[model samples]
Target: MSKATKTIHAAMAAHVSSALDALQAAGTLPEGIERGNVTVEPTRDPAHGDLATNAAMVLAKPAKTNPRALAESLAEELRKVDAIDSVEIAGPGFINLRLSDNAWRDELRAIAALGETYGRSTVGEGTRVNVEYVSANPTGPMHMGHCRGAVVGDALAGLLEFAGHDVTREYYVNDAGSQVDTLARSAHLRYREAHGQDIGDIPEGYYPGEYLKPVGEAARERFGDTYLEATESEWLPVFRGFAVERMIELIKADLALLGIEHDLFASEAELQAAGKPEAAEAWLREHDLVYDGELEAPKGKTLDDWEPVELPLFRATRFGDDQDRPIRKSDGSWTYFGADLAYHFQKAENADALIDIWGADHSGTVKRIKAAVAALTEGSGRNVPFDVKLVQMVQLLRDGEPVKMSKRSGQFVTLADVVREVGKDVVRFTMLTRKPDAQMEFDFAKVVEASKDNPVFYVQYAHARIASTLRKATAAGVAPSADGLDRLGEEELALVKVAAQFPRIVESAAAAREPHRIAFYLQDLAAAFHAFWNLGNDRPEMRILVEDDAEITSARLFLAERIGQVVRNGLAILGVEAVDEL
Candidate 1:
């Protein structure tokens, strides 16, 4: 555990136990109130004070006392604790506690001691977690829509690892799908063009992008027109395999452009190797989750091509889904959901927890997937749980005008294009500035702006500022070491206290599977550091490296160096760049 986390936990345990004792003494509580429910979190509104608790409101009904009365009594008890500078009962029986300045100052010293490891935690306790994301079909280049899931999943994995979870980043390859067949046909058209044949307007259903020309040329070089005159059935598999392999290579390159590397690349084709869909079918049958049924046409919209058909279906409604879903088509081919269910089952066998990051358009699929897992793990009694995080769309804009993108026209913005335009650091940091479930707008102009509005720049600037302070200290023949961190002033001390909260932030972000929390925390930390820096301009003593006092300069430099280390560490977790000299 990081030093910041240890201090926060100790502070919480001490304060909570004291409050329970006071409640017991006043006889205003039940025989045993679950103190485990009490929590200390930094309040969103800083005016409410440092940390606030809703413990009084939560315990009031159980104690049969007015919430305000309970809060008042709790406040009186908290005031006696040396760690608490003051305690106040706010609206609706909330207890807000302000810690003494020394508490904040001491946190700075702890941050200096811990350095880059300041915000890390052991909350996950080495639980194996698999995060599967960006499983885009290998038909063509990845469009802008695929960017959010890739960034969120990667960031979430980083957050989990920092919080001490054994996390595996995975990418599921959809090479067995019909999309790859379409890609083969598309490549065939390109091959015809390479052979000087008039391929015409890119046959109706095939891809029309010029990106496939290389694949075609490579196919021609390897096959030497041998398969050119062959039937579709004889040559389709050959072309499909070649095209999918090349597409995967292209996808890997795109991912590398954005600094993402998956620990596992699971293939859908592997699930049904050698003409056997047994893995998925057997798992579904073992749980009695599969049955023959007819699916109703989708509601709210009527499809002219809709036809009622009976087939093998997963009894998803038995759990919590709205209706049963098909696992096999009438033609005996496995449905998309069937392959996914089996893939998740295979994933469950390898990891303690499963997390799939998907696009928002797949929201309707969440319930059935969870239902399948619950059914599969019914009697064996192992906790084989799964979580699906849906990342909402990112609308790209340039100067407030929406950037046009159309996949059909092959005119959509590619992930590689965005990364090249804004650079990986800006792309990643901006992508995570908003919560996963919230729709985000990526403004190209604002992302590159060198102002506070650009969180990436602001955070980087804070790190750079701290580095400058250290450089100034070193030039004056003073070495800032952990031993001298005790001499930090109020402003320096406040920055340190904020830095000490990193481990707690990591723990919270990992537990919630919300990496945006880390981004938000970093921005706030930067704001605090910037505020302190501005204060230094007004008060010479507040400057991190004071010229007159060697001891004071060394202490301030120690705190500043720690701040820079923490900024780098936090940025690293978000897969963002921390510029030492912005």
Candidate 2:
């Protein structure tokens, strides 16, 4: 295999697979055992080896043989590979493989050659994936809750693209629901307020956010009270459209502050107006997936009327949900879920797989939407995967105190506020420092800290240090070259091994839909570089700018440059800028 084709890990996996084939051909192993399930990944404790494989443990049962016996055979065969320094069969049936120090040195050269595209892979094979995220309602500006999903979705899209997937970053604009209607009413009040009516106390059920005050001002400026005197019916439609359009702008601007932009804005109102909801209803009714039924009063919630009514319902229970979900209310207006089902059905027509990054508050609805997709695909005899990633909330803090926010009272901190406080790079990187499903606290004081505890600062500082070293080296009449790179010491080689995990890290994180892995991986890489840099504190011979031996200095400089390149590439996936200077 060539370096241009795949990473070192892929090459190793292929070689081991071929060894298995050779064993089967020589009648030492079974001829037809599944090999795709074989996993060759890094070990947590580096003391074991650089990489470990469960080939024997996985294949033993299928091949009907003793695992240890097969491991001994596999270990014998793997030793013949060129990159393998030694192979040790560890506890149970895991085979640990250590690569030569020269292999680590060569990976540094590969990083230098590949630059920004170092860890990119063809694993996705051009599968068209739609990643819908930050689908905050188009009623007001994005608040603290929207920040995590925004960064996670954007980073996941970039990660998938790096893995060679055709990804579409999308946002589902909920402009058709009752919320938008309420938004229109709120804007009408704002319009009145803009006209000097002194609209006091903003009625009880309407939005009270000051962000809508601008929409009112814009409407007053544009329409000039043309429909202010008109009846509610005449002005409702006009104001609804105007408010949604303005709210879209507000949402987009908030997203732009965090360096996020969507490839498509899917509108629920458009889907309904285009008769898609009706079409979906007709299709479900034809397949008996929908029916007119009276539902039991919903459990775990208190209702005033508590009366059963006949409604059009989707057969959610048939697809493993607890109960059938209603598509339309008794009054014949479409429910929110009805419009959403139609929207998803429309999205499925364009992509092979679909992903939605939603807040954890919507956790209960995940199963129903999944069942809906399953029924839709099964009914149509087409397999399209739909996955929902529930992002837990982030607790905003200041000086170790919780930043309490409420959308109703408009006391919440906006995304723009946080970004303005500590730059877009800090906001994006800090939001992605944890998994999407895990709740994390974002302390304003901690993120901007210059210490190693702040991951963004630490990684950026490492890159800056490397850049400063290289610039000073260049100024002193020394340049980097491939010559004498293998003469590096143990500390340099250890950093090389840690940096080489970038390729595998990208592939794994992309597959798992987790971008936090990149942030953590960069932290580890930065830690390794910092540790290696500290090696020069007491030992002057290990420093990068040695005056007597130019060859050794050039080799060390070349390695440092590639380390910076890896950090830059990793930061790119997270949508964070890699600063050349702290």
Strongest candidate by TM-score: 2
What is the C-alpha lDDT profile of model 1 across 437-496, one tens digit per residue?
Answer: 998999889999999989989988998888877777778788876566555555665566
lDDT of 2 by residue, 75-154 (tens): 99999988899999998889999998877777877887778889888889999999999999888888888999999999
- What candidate 1 gets wrong by more than 4 Å, as runs, is 1-5, 9-11, 14-35, 43-49, 52-98, 195-198, 274-279, 297-307, 481-489
Can you list the residue pairs that collide in candidate 2?
none
TM-score, every prediction: 0.88, 0.96
Model 2 misplacement above 4 A = 1-6, 300-305
lDDT of 2 at 525: 93
Clashing pairs in 1: 119-502, 119-503
lDDT of predicted model 2:
0.89
Relative to the true structure, candidate 1 has a C-alpha RMSD (angstroms) of: 3.5
